[model samples]
Target chain A: MTDTSATSAAAQAPSGVVDLLGLLAYAELVSFFRLSDAAGLAPDLAAKGELAGVAATEYRHYRMLHERLAAMGADPEAAMAPFVEPLDAWHGRTEPRTWLESLVKTYVGDGIAGDFYRTVAEHADAETAEAVRGAVSETERAEAVAVRVRTAVQEDPKLAGPLSLWARRLVGEALSQAQLVAAARPELAALVARGATGGDSGEGGSGGKGDLAAVSRLFAGLTEAHSARLEAMGLSG
Target chain B: MTDTSATSAAAQAPSGVVDLLGLLAYAELVSFFRLSDAAGLAPDLAAKGELAGVAATEYRHYRMLHERLAAMGADPEAAMAPFVEPLDAWHGRTEPRTWLESLVKTYVGDGIAGDFYRTVAEHADAETAEAVRGAVSETERAEAVAVRVRTAVQEDPKLAGPLSLWARRLVGEALSQAQLVAAARPELAALVARGATGGDSGEGGSGGKGDLAAVSRLFAGLTEAHSARLEAMGLSG
Candidate 1:
């Protein structure tokens, strides 16, 4: 509720956590919308059920985040408010045209977003970290999506090349939109950067706030994980 | 799994129950998609969350029906397959264009569907009736949707006329689709008819299979309830 016109004074303060939770909350909320809509592209009822089930989990994550924000005395709406446009824009740009495309998006998008959140989790306390893990869907859904995408790719080998390209597009659009989010809230960006490098609060790792090299390492890890996921799905990384 | 091309012999038999459960399952599944997608049209996060939460509930109901179908030795996917067209057609025709329109659709659509299912519930076994009640969402969701719609209508009296018209269209479309389904599967229709009239299996009430007079009464009750719902939402019933 502070007049955070600039993040200069408290770049990695508690408000940064609020902003992170807000962003994650809104992200999952929209994921619920986007994933469920994508279910329509499913060819069979079984696949449709799988996607819808995962989407329900996303809404569950959103509700958890919403509650967390309230427990922290942050306005859930306002926490999510700053995120609507960027998240919407990301979804707007990377809309899946086919069921395979939707599956790839689920696999790639959830994979990268989870890595990003896990990086941020280092800066958060234990409970918040667990909550972020719930939002990430790394363990269960990723495996389910992998099996689905892998089976689809095996059934139609032609899908792999195009799906890989589509996945790259998804990651590109996501990264660019993520930059917009980071720029709008420097404190959160700084906090995440410090967490990424395990930096002490007193000094920026590279003697600059949100050290570029540290952020580079963070995304490098995400990129590595993304490549592994792509390989698991029988798509080119 | 029987080749049920002719429903005459099996009218009011167990397959009729499968058909009903399948219809409900698919209805709720697609409802999950439609409602979550509609959440995007919400003006704010709270409204979006409310709609998405209800959509999640629908998915949970869908899962329950899916389990019930499997427990009954019916292939859940095969059971729901017959319903895809009519339900999809209904949604395709009645895609809501505005936030209020979506809310009105939710209210009217859920209200009528619940009543229709309740009429069927009477013929179902006790456990099945309870499950149907769970899927109906008559108590919690109706109140939630009403408050949301009423608040919107009070804020803009001009919306009342158009939204009321929209609700009527929803009911019309719903009834037409219901007839299509009944015509396709006479046993389910007959089962519903018998349930509507509280008749024993020995005789179709009024000396006809699925007595018209009883069906008339069933719909009269539905119409009356629909009007009361409309009135509660401050619309012309």
Candidate 2:
């Protein structure tokens, strides 16, 4: 744990918490909706039911974060409004045409997003970090997607090339959306910069150079995690 | 409750139970999916969340019925397979174009379907009756939809006309699909026919004329109940 004084100083800027939670809450809600939409494409009843079950879990997460925002006297809708466009755009740009593409998108897209949230949680207050962790903790469904995709690709080696290209497109679209979000929400960007500088080597230190370096490192971290996810699914990033 | 011997006679036909449970299971699952889809139309976050919560409840109902089917050694997929086409066609025919239309469909459509299931439950064996009753019992969400539609219509009386027509269309499409289902599933039709005769005047009587008369009474009962629902919604039949 960091020094108590340092934690208090960061906590003074609760807007950052609101920004993160708001973003995560909206993401969860949209993910729930999209997952249900994608469930329609499943080839069989079992797969459809499983995806619907996962979608329910996402709604639960959305509720938890939404309630937290309400408790803090924030309008959940107002807080989530900024995120609707960027996230919806990402979903629109990388629309999954088939059930396999849908599975890969969920696996790879959610994998990177969850990792980014966890990394950002480190710079947040304990409560915020814990909430973020809880919201993203349900990985069992992702494992199901991973196993199913891996098996499908194994059975048909031709699928790997198309799916790999799909994964790359998902990553590209996600990063573009992330850039839009960062450009629009400076508080969130500043928070990340602070998170990068205030930990370990330089406590409570930040600057433009530091922010740039931190963002680059964050991108590297997210990319590496995405590669690991792709590798796990027996595909190259 | 009817005579004990009469109940035992109906219990001999387990296929009817399987058919009922399978239809209810698939209905619950598809309702969950469609509700989530409709939630996207909600004007605000709270409404969206409420609809999503209702969708979750439907998922729980699906799980309950699905588990019971599995316990009874029925393949839920195969059992539900017959239903999918009819239900999908029903949803496709009466697709809601607006948020208010969606609410009316849920309020009126589900209201009638639930009533039918409950009516059918009377002929079901004790265990089957309880299960069907359980699956169709979550009416709190429907009540919410009713209140919302009623208030919206109260605020603007013009909605009453279109929504009333939409509700009628929903009922008409649902009945058409029900006819399709009855034509396709002989076991289900036999069960319904058996329900017709054994319920009222004759405790254990079965004849072609008697069965046809019973079906007429069943239709009348369903129509009457649907009229009551329309009245409750401040609309005409």
Candidate 3:
């Protein structure tokens, strides 16, 4: 964390909005790249094309957040630099081994991340929140993921066991990384912390009681939304 | 090929038009995937993002071709399925080892591809030609590729040698696989053959004289264009 990054984040004040946008931007780009690779696992061309289309939506979101960062006079790349390792580590650790696993990751994994980004964005400045929401509004592809997974599970019930396990792994890896990020950048943790308590509790020192408590609440909501998503695919989340 | 595919191709008449659209669609998807992979080699985040933007253009073009196939009552997946192995082989063999090599492939390789597609599109039916032209018209990203490759070459003169060799290998691999595609789908060969000759020369048997002669001409023109592109980057074509 250089003073310049601190200043960039501080310039956007309420602290960590630049971090938020930067994190989201890098996440989108990585997601797009990963999903394109996952298309190879698709059963057919229709599935492959649909998967590529979904990934393209992620690139569009990246462009939006990237532009937002630049407009704020923050170097988009510099802001994003702080995030590359953690995100890459998370994706690396959770590489999906099959088409169903990939779908579950896309659905269960991206589902929660999108949910988490939205929860934090709502508390940022009006424009930041709007920009984040606009970038994050990728519901249609999520529907496509849902239909494919649900139908596949319905066809062969055996898939439910392994896929449900895969979803758990994806969520587990995600929270582990999220915690690492929170530890490294307390202000971001505090930003979401403020949203959860509707008070200034996260103003405490790094990884303080206030920060962990609020993040727990945020993650709790995300967990619930997608356990239901797993169940919708006949999987035990 | 199956009797059903032959019927479909026959229904399209001119034999190779379905093959053309399908080949083009699959090509776009594979190019998009390769470019996404190449983004990882970018020197900085700006270059990575720009590379990704070019990849997205390929996806949009893929969507365009896919939809056009469906509108013609042809299965988009089926049309693209046949070219999958050959296209995948070509990409796997020619993986770029550096950012400049990737840039050259995008600029010089895709440069000629867009040219060849446009040249042939001009000879197809009005709507088919229009659709092909629309998807293939990706000039802006080409400008991005040219500027980056040219600048990189200018700054470090030594890059020109290997990059020039890489461009030649790229064109070589492209022609070798293209010939494989031609051998497998004579109708498509005939389609481009007619485009080059401006006569009904490709109407003979598979691997016919007219087909080979015309394809040579089409490829000759593509080669000339990209040799110029390579020179523009201070490399010998």
Clashes of each: 0, 0, 0
Which is the better candidate, 2 or 3, if ranked by DockQ? 3
Off by over 4 Å in 1: A1-15, A136-139, A194-211, B1-15, B136-139, B194-218
Per DockQ, the best of the predicted structures is: 1
Docking class of 1: medium
| Candidate 3, superposed: residue stretches over 4 Å from native | A1-13, A194-209, B1-13, B194-208
iRMS, model 3 (angstroms): 1.1
How would the docking of model 2 be graded? medium
- Candidate 2 overall Cα lDDT vs. reference? 0.71
lDDT of 2 at B186: 52
lDDT of 3 by residue, B1-237 (tens): 133543453375456777877888898888888787787788887788888888898898888877767766677888899999988998998999888888888886677557647644765557667877765666534876777778888899988888888999988888888888877777677676565545565467445656566567657655777688887777886
| Cα lDDT of model 2 by residue, A1-237, tens digit | 224444444446344667777777888888877777686788998778878788787788788778766655566777788988998898888888899999998888678657646655776557657766765677435877888889999999999999999999998888778777766665565565445344433233233344445555545555777888888898997
Report the Cα RMSD per candidate: 4.8, 5.7, 4.0
lDDT of 2 by residue, B108-156 (tens): 7677657646645786557656766765777545776778888888999
* Reference-based TM-score of each model: 0.87, 0.86, 0.89
Q: What DockQ values do the models have?
A: 0.74, 0.52, 0.65
Task: Assess the local accuracy of residue A96 in candidate 2 as a C-alpha lDDT between 0 and 100.
Answer: 89
Give the TM-score (vs. native) of candidate 3.
0.89
Candidate that scores best on TM-score: 3
